[model samples]
Target: MADYPILAVVGHPNKGKSSVVSALTQNDQVHISPLSGTTRVAQHFSLKLDGETVFELVDTPGFQRAAKCLAWLRVEELPADQRPARVAEFVEQFRSSGQFFDEVELLKPIVAGAGIIYVVDGSLPYSPEYETEMEILRWTGRPRLALINPIGGDAYVAQWQQALNQYFSLVKQFDPLHASFDQHLQLLRSFGELDSRPGRIFDQAIEQLEQYRRQKLEQAARILVENLYRLLTYQQSSSRLEQAAREQLPELLPAEISRFNQHLNWLERDGQQQLEALFLYHRLESDLARLEVRQSELMDESQWTLWGLEKKQLVLVSAAAGATLGLLADAGLGGSSLFAGAIGGGVLGGVSGWLGLDWFKQQLPAWLQFSAEQHLLGPVKDPNFAFVILGRALSHARAMLARSHADRERLTIHQAGDHFMQSLEMKVQIRLLKQCKQLVRQGPQGQAAEQLRAWIYQQLTA
Candidate 1:
């Protein structure tokens, strides 16, 4: 237990104590509130890797009667060595008195050999009013570290640091709301500096934590690649499609596309949920736009061009990937009737190699096909659709990675950032287009899926 290194996080009322615990332990279920006295009892949270405890954090209620409790400790003249025993006696005497319940609960772990983690709001000016609480922690004879949490802003961080440095062995500024993963590892390394006995354990925990993060990223890439294949090649059929007359399809098509959109959204959401769980986010909601296909067309310019490649890039990539001159004609290019093989050439060149929107409208029968004598509604045929799926996935993954577990806001996948796929080298883009072709023709179980997964993993790590 001594080598395990339990840390008791104590602070003033309404400070970001629970937020610190949530951030450090990577546990979101910890209760957090702006109201004072939200944490009534001490709760233990452990960061475990493969069922082995790396370390533990104790979220304890803030001090309620610090000045009065310090008064009692000073009733008798005591040497520094005897102070800890006196603090223990106070806990024993007031165990059930209900007079100093918060103090007793907060000190229980410290008395039992847990180190101290004192939290303060650096957004407010430093005051001597906090000394009583700080002095009592010093008397407990445990290694102490003070955290200046800038809950609102860092207006008074230097002020807080000057005072905290005099009270604790180590002091740091940490914002649980927005700290990055590298900052997390740095904080853990500082925890190892508190004492020599538990230093080895903390080092091991840091190594394992880094390895665990890499594994999660790899798993996330797999999820994205698999989901992309499913969405691109997805097909749905119902008795309604078979029963409807050919003329009725125009009217019936919109409803079927709506259903197809719902299923595609469902598939994408399922992948997102798996990613959330992989990263230990149990209640994450992504605010990405719904996937849709209107009248056998890709989404409008605002969405299609922003998330996927721009139309010009699409044309260049398609031409580079061996699309025929006639396929280029369909992507808003003017041509006579001489190049009639454009549609057939585009189909043979593969979906990622050409913009066949005119051909798309002229060929609804291509998407709504009669295969195996059954009318099947989709597996969207647009070349740019693959890029759209990949772009959205990269955006969502980056957002989840950048988020802190303590963040309570809904995860919004903003389209404001530069699209990753849009910035890739032309050669890589060509290779990706080729992979999309393989996935469409062969599904997710082949060599193409493996190559795509590797490429995605590289992007995530980069």
Candidate 2:
């Protein structure tokens, strides 16, 4: 790993040095706080790909007595070529002393071979007080980059940039809380430009990081598709059935429906957890609308538009699906010679599609079935149910993808206007509809589910 880049993140207290490390490594476990002296010692973290460390970052304590340390270093008349050795002597002298503990810890990595990343709050006005720390770091003679973190706003960014340009070879504005993946890659690219020693290695690291992200997205798609299948085809059966249970089953529908909904929620959450873990977000929390089937009217029109398809598009798709099912059933019964069954099925399907949630309201009891020997809750009958499940999964997955590891707040998944299903071409929509029907009948193990997973991966990449 000596051939790979090692960057020492040095800064004043509470200026988002740890936040930069968190975002760069994509590790949520990194400690962060607004209070001073949060990181008290130097710790090394590595970004590894396939069990190989790509690069390393040293999260070191902020400069506690920079002015005093610099004053100590200047007591001896040293030439410019020997100044780094003087800084090294200061670290050796104060390694065990309690006076410049923070300064020694931060300078240890820079005295070694680590490149410097000096962080400062771009949101705050620049002052001469911070120059003490900057001047101390400049004495180390390490390749340096200055990250002006706009912790609040970019109002003071240019002010910081003007000052940092004098000490650092590169000055850039980086916001850890909201940086996209591309920004992260670009930042790493800039790290490569800091020094020529590991330029090719840093480029390889960026490529590996992109590949790892794509693989995680593929895994996320699989998790989401599997969850959609499970939710759509889920059934809750009762073993407490008696001979006369059919008569009482209708009364027990509410409790059974509640249990079914609970299980659905659990399944959805389980998939979400898998996705979060895949992206290395162990402590992620989300504020999302509930994913469940309502007993009153399936789903509201507004929700359908948000999570499934628009009213007009859903109606047309559902009507076509119904007519196909009707024609298939007619052919299976005897032959397609019976135009009556096909025509009736098309009209009923079209009307049901037009009715939307109202049709689901009327057919709720049908979904809750009871026979002489069996009592079951569901394999959701409505075609629109498929879109609802799929839409919610994609929403949660996309939210996780967009989130930065440096964020401490709960992820809020808003209901967006354009749904993935709604934007698809009609043929693609029809193919998805067909695959969803196959899922209900054949479970999530066959070629149909594979096709759905492939489509989901395509959407994720898009």
Candidate 3:
């Protein structure tokens, strides 16, 4: 809601205007191609100063004397009603041209309102044309600061400052790329001065900017923590089945699921490191607890049990069923092929049994674990039901693995991790919703909880 102060960069062509804007905003908003007159129109960007949204930078196109002359002609010749259209046409024509003369004709907006940032190359002697441009800019009567953009050599620094002093109120030599945060702050503070009097408005603005920046950092840190929790939780849940089942399977049995978990972990760690490197606090412990609580409430007792060894056995059985179906996925079998298929099929059958075990463990209580195991590995069991259940789980696992891989390749590891965490957060919210619904059915606390749950769900899900 805070209104940011606008700082406009204006100067002759090829004077590092885009570079200065890029440095100030820490974004590549203004295209910085080697060709002169690249910036054809004003471009705006916002950045936090101090803890507040109190600063903005506007990159204006390079000044061109010839373009100004043509524009002036159009303005004079066109009727008052047609002047706007003519002016637009003339400006467009100028933008298309390769050549432009340094002049103040293009600096009307900054002169009228915004703070002025005038950049001049310090490697060459101050030119008369630049002096003329400064004189034109001065007519707009805005607070102006001249920045000498050092290039090539330092020999012309003294001459540049002397020439700059003839027209500008203050001059400073600044390298945009190498400027430190303190130095940048000091420059903004200097701009806060107007008519030899200090501007108190920017003091509060800077403080606010700093606060906003800190908040952004904190938010990023929170995001990283959320990602880590998702990675850890998902792995813990899925691993119970994978590990136990894998050991019983053939050696070449694809370790894709395990590898996917590892990849997810790497992404979370990378995101954490990125936040830490920026000096942002890593609040992993607190975030982890929040996620765990939320997860506990979201997943049912049965689902929670899916994270254990009993559940893993079911996943193993499911994998076996999946392998058999996958083999049938490619028909035509010779004697050797059938023999290989049988061996592969047995390994897959064992995996299917493992998956079934996992599924049953989640739904059944601990007291029933032994009974379920007996039923699964027992002498009399429904082979058809086992096949169906294992096949479904295996299919889901394959799809999940593919999606995880695609996500990894499409997004940076950190971004993917963030996404995974967000998904977990949503799942947690959904669980909370169910809890609220159950409570509502019981009356009293349930009604209020349901309302609150609905509000939060709408906000988050929307």
Candidate 4:
């Protein structure tokens, strides 16, 4: 039972309570409104790891009848110990009463044994009026903490912190919209410090949350591996036709390339959805348009600056891949053979085809044999283009990692000081690039697939 702690997030209307829950749970589905009293009832969101619940967060409607509720509780007709019963009596009388409905909804969970996590807008000046609400919560005699969430700026944080301390046993400041990964954990750890609740399970909650974080990173790595494989190896073909129809091939071919490129773009969008869902930000649409990593086109120059490798790095890896193919070609021809001239041309062609290949150049596959009936394109070419695919994937993953789950602002990724691929070791980069090339050639087997997954995992998370 200690493994599950129920926390009720309560506050005044429009004070960013939903934002706090969203950030803590990494869930974007919670509705947040600027208008007063958006959440009219209590909503429960649970944090689960491996299909089991770790902790639950209850987002309750904000206080509406604090003054009246406090006024009723202070009648003094009831003894000190009986005040809790008075509070309960008030709920029984007004649970469905129109004016006190919001207050009742917010207080129901606290009366039921959930710990209180009171939220306040630190951006607003601290006032005496909210004391009525705090006094009402205190009358319930539940374990409680105060959260000073700065919705706009921190000009009043010091004041909010000072005033909140007198009422709540613990007072902490959190900016739900901008809090970092560490701040989320620290806030949860602070909840474990409440004195009223014995056998606190926050330590267990923290452990599960951390494990969930690493598992999410692993999911992102798998996405890069499998999606990159399909995209790099995607192939399409059209049989060449003779006669008057042959002239129309020009129009049909470019359209085919466009269609294939569109498919790759579809893969990217699908991947974005997967990563967002993994972290529980399922409702928010990606704000990729104005960011540095935005891809206006598959190989847009702007994206290249953000996710592409340096030209020199691409050249070195490409040269190594070419050399490897050359050795294979030479080995295929036996050692003691002067009759090798017959196949010598084939060897030079193979080596030069790899060395001089632009990978990015818009050309139909040279492998397309002009047999009486065929023309084919794709199985995306090597290193440079593979880097292009990888660069975009990495940029998207990093953006999702850095964003606060509660942030609704248009998704934007500022350029990392350097390219994402630039951080990997040279050999890792080469091996990864070669793997992309191999996928294009024969597809990944069990061993190769695991190697691909490991390399992608390192680049994404290491």
Among the numbered candidates, top TM-score falls to 1
Candidate 3, residues 234-319, lDDT tens digits: the string is 32222333444434433433343234324543544454445433332233334333433332321122322332212333333323
Give lDDT tens digits, candidate 1, residues 30-115.
88887889788899998877777778999999999999999999998999999999999999989889889999989988888888
Model 4 residue runs over 4 Å out of place are 1-3, 77-81, 195-200, 239-248, 286-296, 300-303, 324-374, 438-445, 455-462
Model 2's alpha-carbon lDDT is 0.74
lDDT of 3 at 313: 36
TM-score of model 1 relative to the true fold? 0.87
TM-score for each prediction? 0.87, 0.85, 0.48, 0.83
Model 4 per-residue lDDT tens digits across residues 322-377: 46545223323222121222123443232223222221224422323234555545
Residue 131's lDDT in candidate 4: 90
**Per-candidate RMSD, Å:** 5.0, 5.7, 17.1, 6.8
Model 3: C-alpha RMSD to truth?
A: 17.1
lDDT of 2 by residue, 337-439 (tens): 2222222443333222322222132343444454555666666556666876787777777777788888888777656656677887887776777888887
Q: 1 or 3, which is superior by lDDT?
A: 1
Relative to the true structure, candidate 3 reaches a TM of: 0.48
Clashing pairs in 2: none
Model 4 lDDT, residue 250, Cα: 56
